[model samples]
Target chain A: MWGVATGPLRRRAVAQNLSTTLGCPVLLLLAQGYDRPSYVDVALVLALLGPIGTLVFARLLAEDLDEDPPRAQALTWAAAGFAAAVVLAVCVATEPGRAMVKLLVTGALLIGGNLVASRALARGMPTAEERHG
Target chain B: MDDALIAVALLLVAATATAAVATRDPVHQALVLSLLGVALALLFTVLQAPDVALSQLAVGSALTPLLLLLSVRKVWRRRQRQGRTE
Candidate 1:
């Protein structure tokens, strides 16, 4: 919904990051049914990379994004909240151990990275002239 | 139950692939392609191949779109410069 609803490049990038990092991980974890805890590693990588992906789009498409910077504060927070809820739920399901810690770290990265990425996109990257000067 | 998940993921992949192909603009195609990457990763996960899904997520989710958009930007800049000079 978020990806399709937004027309702006930056907004779509955020949506893509959110879906890939938070949404898919949670769904994949649930589908995995905790059969192999190693699967959580996939989410870990995604949590780490998804926002960086958005940052790439923000930096490269600065001019396009500058004209219509997305102010998606509400949506970003909602996604973060959802990530928190999913993490808490998964932690509850798993035993209190290293795996749980890993999940927590992934959750933190997912939420923190997402917020940072969204803010970066909203602020827009410095133009080449501003950067060089 | 697993079948349901697989079916949903397959449907998503199909839809996004079609959207990516149907889109005319390179920029829009890149966006759809990113989404398509996510969808494919989901399908791979549902099929019980986290390793494959991991690589797909890494390559598809960010790398592919980054490369595509970067090239598009470069091409557009060159075209604009040529247009100005001509």
Candidate 2:
């Protein structure tokens, strides 16, 4: 496994992925303690927006990251796997129903979005000069 | 137990906020600011305000940083262009 590098953009990407994934456990904790089904929406929104946020950075900071495009393949996949595992655990804990389906959808979005964002970061967006030229 | 979690979240918010301010570089400060947003969301969630946390996640985790980074990029590009013209 390649060690995670220390570039600023790379670190930013990693932090974004980890924070988004962290929401799953927080959701589970809230569900366990509180009887509120609405809290799940927090995780859902996070799963939805987290990657888009990263992509924003990837696109806007392309020039800065072009020199050291993040390449944390192992870490990104590990975080995605962790998210999938959490979603599965939550699914098993909850009775199968709309909530389970929602959880599954959120999990799919979280994993898929993070993967796409990471790939974009690794690939690096085209610089303005390159785009115009 | 819940108190401990809240305390931890509060600590995170303080630490990240302080770091965001202390960092000199706008780009790095934006990074810290995003982390601060995540911390604040966690604090709000612990305080049993998921709605607030949701909005915080939306704005803090991504949008604020995006705006900050965009501004920094624009300024840097303008400076570069000015340097070329001069």
Candidate 1 Cα errors over 4 Å, as ranges: A31-34, A126-133
Please give, for residues B1-86, the per-residue lDDT of candidate 2 as tens digits. Answer: 88998898888777777666677878767666666776787788889998898889889767898889889988998999999999
Per-residue lDDT tens digits for candidate 2, residues A11-78, read: 76667656666665666557656767677788888778778777877787776777887777887788
Whose lDDT is greatest here? Answer: 1
**How does candidate 1 fare on TM-score?**
0.89
Question: Model 1, residue A78: displacement in angstroms?
Answer: 0.8
Q: Each candidate's lDDT (Cα)? A: 0.76, 0.75
lDDT of 1 at A119: 87
Best prediction by DockQ: 1
